[model samples]
Target: MKKTTINYLHVGYWLLVLVQTLLVSLGTGVLGTTFDWRLFSQIVLPVKFLQVLSSAIFFYINYLFLIPVFLKKGNVIKYLPSLIATLLIFTPLYYFLEQRLYPMIGWKSYDADLNFWFAVMITLSSNFINIFLAILLSYLMDWRTMRIQKEIIEKEQFKTELAFLKSQVNPHYLFNTINDIYALTQQQSAEAPNALLKLSELLRYMLRESDDQFVPLSKEIIYLENVIELQKIGQKGLSFVNFEVVGEVNKLKIAPLILINFVENAFKHGTFNKKNNPINILIIIHEQLLHFQISNQINHVKKDKTGGIGLVNVKRRLSLIYPEKHELTIHQLENEFIVDLKIALYD
Candidate 1:
């Protein structure tokens, strides 16, 4: 049985016992002429005891027989009928013990109506009331419990997804930067030292801020600049990339790595072409609304499809972190792919 149902049944047990005690006392007063308060107390006490015993026995019968059949094979027909049958079975047994069995054990009987009619009336009334109450309470408790469990599950899933996003951002960045460094190592470039320095700064940022849900917008801008510098070391010429930031950052915190994947995607795909191809990034913050726009000039003649994993990861991260709080638009033209994102910042 559901928790609320059991609770209601428990409350009903107490109410029933109190009512029976009151009725038995009144009946004792009417049936006898002496009207001794002690006699009334004695009559009420055994009724209370018998009520408690009957409640315990009824609980056992419901637990052992009624619940299994009701839960598994029950329809509307079986539900009410089986409960009524169980009540009928137990009531006669109880009346027998109350009238004959207790009297044999030197316990005086209270009222001597241990017949079929009274047993049937009590059984039908009590079980009918219990059935109605139990079903309603059980349904409500089940609904409440289900809602609470679903909310807990969703929170846990969101946390797990956030952790996964952070992991994706850090490793994806490291792998790309390391690949660029490997190329510099092979070609013996003059900007290799600057690349290593920027790499170290990027690693520091990751270690410090990746574990947090939000980081200062200024910190994120610095980290983006570091990544851009590292990417520039591997570029063949300055014309390959262009980045600009126009924003006042005093007290704003945003989800980190929100803009890096676009830049990374741009460089990974746009760098191989030595033509006038360019990757443009512009970020502006105004009144707690940050607008980020990135456009990468793609060479459709020689476009590479191998650089989309980081972009996809970042998209997933943005969705998880900013459900209804951010807007992302992506457009793929013949020669360029553009991404525009507007995010709300919080302190």
Candidate 2:
């Protein structure tokens, strides 16, 4: 609970205590009996206020100190005895104060009504109420605090796992890309520097940006574009990789690396040079929804795996991050494998 809310509860609780004290002191008999203004003002009202104040003291002492310091550690030895001692000490303090305050404040004291043992029993019972309330509210607060902490820890652990899943990659992609870069350098190809730059940006994003829970949708699209560009570079620019985007991708954020694994799989195991069955990648955004679809013709022989994510892990990530806000479907035919993913984006 919030601090302000807790403070409000405390205020309301003390107000009820005040009301309870009034009800207990000035009972229905006060309405029935002859009005004794002196008794109500001097004897009953002042002593009742003192009783309420003492109850407040006992509540705070137990709630803030005794419960946390001793009972929280299950130290009954210190906790129980300390509680009894506190009760004994404060139970009679009221009568003692009353005796003194009556004389000093020049308030009329009804000596017969102020019996010592009677006052102690009353104080003891009220103190027990404080004890019960203190123990109950203290533990209730502790439970709420622990639940909040557990949720925070779980969210952090979830992010750590998601980032680990995103970072997993097959080494062959780097090897092939590096080889492509070397070949380009040897042949004096113009795309070599841009390919290297794209590789640098991809790595930078994978290492740094992907660690964030969400990245700009625009940045993710650029990352996807870079991946396609670099993969084409490795195939000597002859790979028929068709990429398209539609609608607004700006002012929106998505979970990082969410779409990359499927695209990489399409490039890894799909036909590259066939014009009739080329790889198809599309991204569409409308009204805070993103639609990502990718499909490719089976090459008969599986190509090298690139960036890594099994379907199981990707599904788990989507469930963890987006849950009911996302939908995913996969389709496999004799010659083609297709993946369709849609997500509710955040702006």
Candidate 3:
């Protein structure tokens, strides 16, 4: 809480207590309540002044010192005795202040006609009310502060983990692409110039757009298309991957680079039999819902190991970003591997 807010709570609570004390003192419950100015100023004011000041002192002592030192540490034994000790110390001090300060200030002192133990009991009971309020407010404020801190830490973790995943996965793909461009240059192939240009565009997209939390669906689609084109060039102009987009991509947005891992995974693991498309990716959009599917023929020669961030990283990303907003299913059939994913988009 802000310091001003906390101050307001304290001031308001004490004011309420003072009002209640005045009401009881002036016989509020007894039908004809009369406000005697002299009685209020002389007797009630002096007594209430001492009561309120002492209560406020003990409240801060318990709130700022005792509670954290004892109760928060689960030391109830020490905490309860500490409360009793402070109440004992402050109750006697109230009498001493009344005897000395009231005469000096020319205000009449209050003396309730009761035995010593009975007066001590009454004082302890009233003091406990202040203690109870202090403890309640302290726990409430501390709990809220801890919860806010947890949420901030979680958000930071999300960003850091996402960035880490993005960084770890790309070196493998970029290395292969660089090698392909280098071979094309050695042969002086005409496609070499175009490949280098496309790589430049891809690099620009990664550095500029991929850092964002979200990107337009059109930009993501274009990025994917450019990736497929570069991969085709890397394969010596063979069409081993097929990508299909259904429905309008306008006005839609998605997490940047979210879909790239599945495509890269397909290229890493799938066999090209020269019979059918080695990798097939299909994406469908309707309203704010998206359905994505990718499948590739099993390349038994490939194993479940890669230097790139793999399916685990992608799964973690989807959970963190989409949470209950997405569904994913993976199937490993005898001859093919398939991934089906659905996401509910947000504005």
Candidate of highest lDDT:
2
| Candidate 1 ranges with C-alpha deviation above 4 Å | 1-65, 73-82, 89-116, 139-173, 182-194, 204-208, 211-216, 236-253, 271-278, 300-302, 305-309, 334-336, 345-347
Q: Please, what are the lDDT tens digits per residue for candidate 3 over residues 1-347?
A: 68899799888988888877777766643223666677677766767767787778888999999998999999999999998888777766765555566556554345553455654676687677778877898899899999989999999998999898877556678999999999999999999999999889888888889888888988888888888888988888665777899988888889888888888888877775454656888999998898999999877787556533578888888998899999999998988889999988755
Q: Alpha-carbon error at 245 in model 2, in Å? A: 1.2
Q: Please give each candidate's TM-score.
A: 0.63, 0.82, 0.77
Q: Report clashes for each candidate as comma-separated counts.
A: 0, 0, 0
When superposed on Cα atoms, how far off is each prediction in RMSD? 6.5, 4.0, 4.2
Highest TM-score: which candidate? Answer: 2
In model 3, what is the error at residue 147, expressed in angstroms? 4.6
Full-model lDDT for every candidate: 0.73, 0.81, 0.81
The better-scoring model by lDDT among 1 and 3 is 3
| lDDT for position 167 in model 1 | 75
lDDT (tens digit, per residue) of candidate 2 on 1-347 = 68999999898988887787667656756424676778677766776677678789988988899889999998989999989878777756867765667556555334565677776776687787779889999989889999999999998998787776665654567788889899999999999899999999988987898778899999999998888888888887678878999998889999987887787678777887867778999999998999999999977676445423456677888999998999999997888889999999999
Off by over 4 Å in 2: 2-50, 65-84, 106-113, 169-171, 303-309
Off by over 4 Å in 3: 1-4, 19-53, 70-82, 96-119, 136-160, 271-278, 300-309
